[model samples]
Target chain A: MNDRIYMDNCVTSAMAPEVLEAMKPYFGEEFWYPGSFVSTGEASSAAFEGFREVIADALNAAPQEITFTSGGTIANNIALKGLALAHSGEGRHIICSTVDYPDLLTHAAYFEKMGFEVTYLEPDELGFVSAQKLKDAIRDDTILFMSTMVNHVVGTIQPIGEYSQVLAAANHKIWFHVDAGQAFGKLHLDVKALGMDTLSVSAHKIHGPQGIGALYVKKGSRLGAYIHGIKRFEGVQPGGLSLAAMAGFAKAVEIVYKDLDGSIKQLRELSDYLLEQLESQIEYVELNGPRGEGRACHNINVSLDFIEGEAITIMLDMHKITVATGSACASQGLKPSYVLLAMGKNQVQAHGSMKFTLSRYNTKEQIDFTVAKLKEIAAILRERSPLYNAIKKKQEK
Target chain B: MQYSEKVLQHFMHPQNVGEMENPDATATEGSPACGDQVTMYLKVDKENLIIEDVSFLSYGCASNIATASIITEMAKGKSLEEAKKITWRDAMEALDGLPPVKAHCSVLAADTLQTAISNYEIAHGLKEVPDFSKETIIGELKKIIYPQVGEDIITLKMVKYVGFEEKTGEVLIDLNLMSFDQYRDNVAEEIREHLQKYPEVKDIKINFPS
Candidate 1:
């Protein structure tokens, strides 16, 4: 019966009101198959292509190079698998960081099965891969360099611009892919400035409708096709994307950039307040990701000793507060976050990891309320942990 | 997120959510690889060979807690020998079957129960558990988790018997279990697929008589 408080923005955001309003006409009166020659359909097609131009302009890429897909997962799949296949003859070896999103990892796994070699380079203890190490990782036959704009679990925003420059200097025109699903709307992304051959973005992460996302493919990039269908989005994405959803996604991006500074300031202040409260109000807790600007502006991850992440998540849910956990039990893979593990956390530490991602809509009041609930839950769960009890007993001596 | 009704009932109102003091035996099963763990305690009547009571603490997902809770429900009054026959499949069936992805939660519960039983066996100096196979049981179990494709049961420490006749091509398993006297055959079906592939394992028998 408590008020619902959502801290799972990294998972998905509620659609922005402006986005909803823009998409309304498309759902009913403006419903038409894009690219059709008929009047209504032609109008729909123009609008669809118009947003495509807007997104391309945002990324500083040619409109012809922008392709729409189902969402972040599909965008990533196309980028990784498509580029790997397209460049296999150039070399079978690929350089990738361990903190890459699981979707990219899964695709790397598939590539490995196909006889392409992938080197899973680990980042430093702070979830960072140095440019020098990345450059050194480039083998003579290394065909691609893939990482993410941000670490999904801990919100460590990878320095994409620096790493892309390293790759460019190491191997000219090497396929550099960045899965920017979490970072796209929160951070400024320019394909030219970052020197990235491809980048992936999802609409829902920016308060747009689900099932709509875009990939910025550099104009000269030789990316192959993954899905076999009509060349709907410039011969890359097969099958048509949801026209209404695409319009909604474009408006979402517009509103995000139009109010970019204000939103960023609000989210930064909100997350900063949360971290301060969590640190000052709780005991036996440690933040997982980097502390300040090195991290994403919208998220925070912390590990609480003597308690499982799922236990805390469930307990918090009972109080009408929502967050996310990557503990073995919390994940569908039944694995602790490889991202956290690669960053040097032990099993227990990884199992206790909890993440809270904020949105522009979040308020200072919600952070205070959630922190109070977390303190209460931590005390109760610590009381149940035998390890905590044993440690207390030993301390008594 | 769409858990079964049974999972919701057990997770929302979990039973035996604490530890016991001075237990006859205790065991913990968890791996850094999975990031989930369950530590179980047992109070056993050594002379009568019954599991008097059981309790557990888990750092895992909803299924992990639910599965552990249900196993304690199933094993509370059972004999230790009977409790040893409790399989993860029993817990799966009791919860009306876990989501396939969460099947491992029941496997964790079952494995931890076996580890607790083994701990009991060690503390009381009961005779070492009978060999599950002619070959070193641990080595053969390393080849697989169950008779099926999941986790390897050897590392899980739940293998009870593996009988193979080279000449007659007959394979039999005592089949480690954590619950459900009636769910033995379902587990058997999984084992049959695993062992039946071999030219030597012409016939397979999983003896779980309820």
Candidate 2:
């Protein structure tokens, strides 16, 4: 097949066929606006309820607890800043990892600007954070602990479940939020089981329409104290909804959940085959994030030293393969990714990090072809690079 | 992302990359931490005010790396005065286009060219070249330590070398602790602070482990 081998799924995924089909009715037949209409309109409130049920089921939460937002960014903003603002009276301390998405950090900064103390914890070289370290950082003034389930750049899955236990031991009152845009559908997440108060997910990352996402708030949670919108999401998320996009998101989540085990296995196999192909062809390739079972199956952050990542990306594009250097949101930046830096990577390695994420549609042949093309381009670039040759010769001894 | 044909052309096949034999002036910039490095070599015809040759070695992102290579092509054969005036705007235009953020990299290209020209003048002794080498750096420290140990570079092996960057004229050194802990430990910092007192010394080379 001539399908373009896209490995930047962590940025945004292509809409699933099933998601498109489910959304078709909303764009055409049942196109009524959900806000002002009466009972007999072309679209009914039931449409939104249906979407809510699907998302709640996928999240293992009560349907009433799910609140829709524009995307992961907005969901994270509301969850983090809102919780901080609401609970500042109880405790002014907020803890976040230095490697978190800047959007979430920006929200934390808003809390800082509002007179709350914020601590940005740094991760280890493997991009893993210890629960003990987080507990040590926490104090009596700590009101919330926020982190990522999957780091957007390195794709290192954090021990959020373990951190949850640490938080519970300290005080059940501390709110925990996870930005799982890169991990939601790919990895298993059960909000209550993980002892999370707020969870952010994006439709685009899960093969649904773009610019649509949802946040999960546990039932009877006091998130209402932090929320400020025209209409209260039981006092937390206070915005109207995108019914059509939410419907598509709902369908996408349904499809993903229905085939979760099979899709996970397929993704694991595809990632394995691709990683093997890369390893066999490219010498001196350093895989970032975790070394084996500790990593997320969908993310493989590889650094081919001496060759710049932007160059590798362009050459791969020439081969009709799409991948990302660091997070898609941060790609426009010139500085090396802060996420990789927090993991103790020097500047060159951080700037050279590339994320390869696989979706359900990637085939084995495509992976092989991509590997062959990457090897050829890397070899050509290395031959022309004096830096690479110098480093190679020095290490040869 | 479709780059202009000019960008692709320059990126795919840049001209004047690598070294020149016995260059009159050389400049290296960028950091391995930042995932990019560039070294530029210049041969200036002093009598004619012409740049006889210019070459570069870059380890960086595709566009900047390519931009560095293309810069030499644009600069070659131009007068020293003309090459110094080459702005990042001109190079970006020559490449057809570069991302706005990478525009800073273009400035790095311009700065390297200027620094190379300046280094040429200094290396040729057309201007006063400052000496911040380990010998001179240690000489300054000996003046401070001579009062205590009465020993200098010729006498003792107290100095331990750490690291050095040749292009930027920067160096780091360490003075390993002997059996005694209080045997003049602030020599490194004292030397570093003293070196800043001299303007001609563009950078300080240090020795650590004391």
Candidate 3:
């Protein structure tokens, strides 16, 4: 139905057709080094910097403050490791949510290796880490605080603005970084508006080309470069940016937010329809993330009892529908999701977790097909589960 | 997960997916907490000591389901001795190949099969059943003493269960140890050496529950 339903947008979205068209000239006709002083090089650099201006304008920051990164993970690494190294003399303590993007948590481990202390804050039952928790965690030696604006697994929108306000009122000399990779295009993210000193966004998550992202490092923030190179990225990342990818990123940003209100409404309608159908038709299925406000408008995560998520994904994949499971089977570690565990879910419930992220291109028909297929698969799996049989026997008695 | 073609084929159409009502022996292994478990049901031939019918109900990834399906097919119509010898490697070979990480799924399936047979031996009390009682085994184990506990093994209550088959004289004792692991081998050897003197005890197995 409708050219193979794709519900894995949080993994990566399809490059927008308009973005591809905008990037064509940069790849073929204007394919010169952006660093040269010749006419062609000047033309290419001007076009590349013009896209950078689009990013700066969207985030309400100066052009110099925006640094083009390889992608979300690299952007996150630069923020966490970069700040940790630069501010080591000032302090050695850092704080972040346990359910933050893996790149952020991994860097926190690296910080620990370097003798820096890290505190991982657990989120509420609905996966919301409030500003009060962030406030209570601040210490005198706290050098940096980083958290994702929207969780990648559950899509629970954190209170980035209020958390930044708490840090501001405390007036502590801690650097604040927001991993806005999942929230930048969907949510109206302005670095100044959110009172955040630094933030990072990945372009591929919003229908832009892969391998391109941007990090807004506010003026006067001290950050040391981990990647040693000469003169490129002001020696921060020390590499050249892909001119075509940046052009596609800018064009995708424009296409997605062209009618921002309309696109958001569409996302909400599709998301709500899926949740409603699953709740009405399925038994023993529970939503893993929040429902209305504070939850992402285009994402839904659910956990079905007496079943496994990897089986569900594979069954759906056989039906030409794509989705993602957060089960240990889906992970390389062969253990349940640490994110779901941090959210207070037991291992069995966490093993049954599945995430569906809608895009601007998804439709109601696709969700209906997915929900219908899920009902059949869940029933079959439950029938074959000994735990399910025992529970049914007990209930019957 | 880079699953083998054989795994996908079996998972798509699992054989004997449900359980039997009051089968000869049924055992559940693994847990939902670990995301891999299977409960095997066996109907053994009372006269011949062969597994006549077998089925499984599992909760795990594709490998778990596929391994259960294949192991049950391999175990059915085979002697209890042959079935007990099926290893995780056999399950993987039967599956053609499995992802290296998912090798545990094969292990879980084979372990569950052995568990079902043990449960059969425990549940069945035939006319040919041995006269050995739980107290008799405990009395025999009392001959061995652990240095750390400074007492006979029975007083420590580490021996949780004892099952003996009359026809084969097979004895199984489950141990729940409270001491460190380094001394376990020595303690086990002393018990095995003591039990060996009884010619009626044809086979003996010492198992510790993790």
Candidate number achieving the greatest DockQ relative to the actual structure: 3
DockQ of 2: 0.25
Candidate 1: regions farther than 4 A off: A1-3, A33-38, A225-228, A232-236, B1-56, B67-97, B107-210
Quote the chain B TM-score of every prediction. 0.63, 0.58, 0.60
Question: Model 3, range B122-207, lDDT digits (tens) per residue?
Answer: 67753243455656677666544444433556766877888887688888888776444545765676567546656788998988
lDDT over C-alpha atoms for residue A111 of model 1: 83
Q: How good is model 2 by TM-score?
A: 0.80
Candidate number 2, chain A TM-score:
0.92
lDDT of 2 by residue, B49-137 (tens): 68988888776666666678777888899987788777656777888766543544455566578778878777777667655565666
TM-score of 3: 0.85
Residue runs of model 3 more than 4 Å from their true location after superposition: A232-236, B125-210
Could you give candidate 3's per-residue lDDT for residues A183-300 as a string of tens digits? 9777777788888878898899989999989889999888888666654434125667678988998898887767777877889899999999999999998999788877888889
Best by lDDT: 3
By TM-score rank, best first, the candidates go 3, 2, 1
DockQ of all candidates, in order?
0.23, 0.25, 0.30
Q: Output the better candidate (2/3) by lDDT.
A: 3
- Model 2 accuracy (lDDT, Cα): 0.74
In model 3, the Cα lDDT at residue B137 comes to 75
TM-score of each: 0.79, 0.80, 0.85
Give the best candidate by TM-score: 3
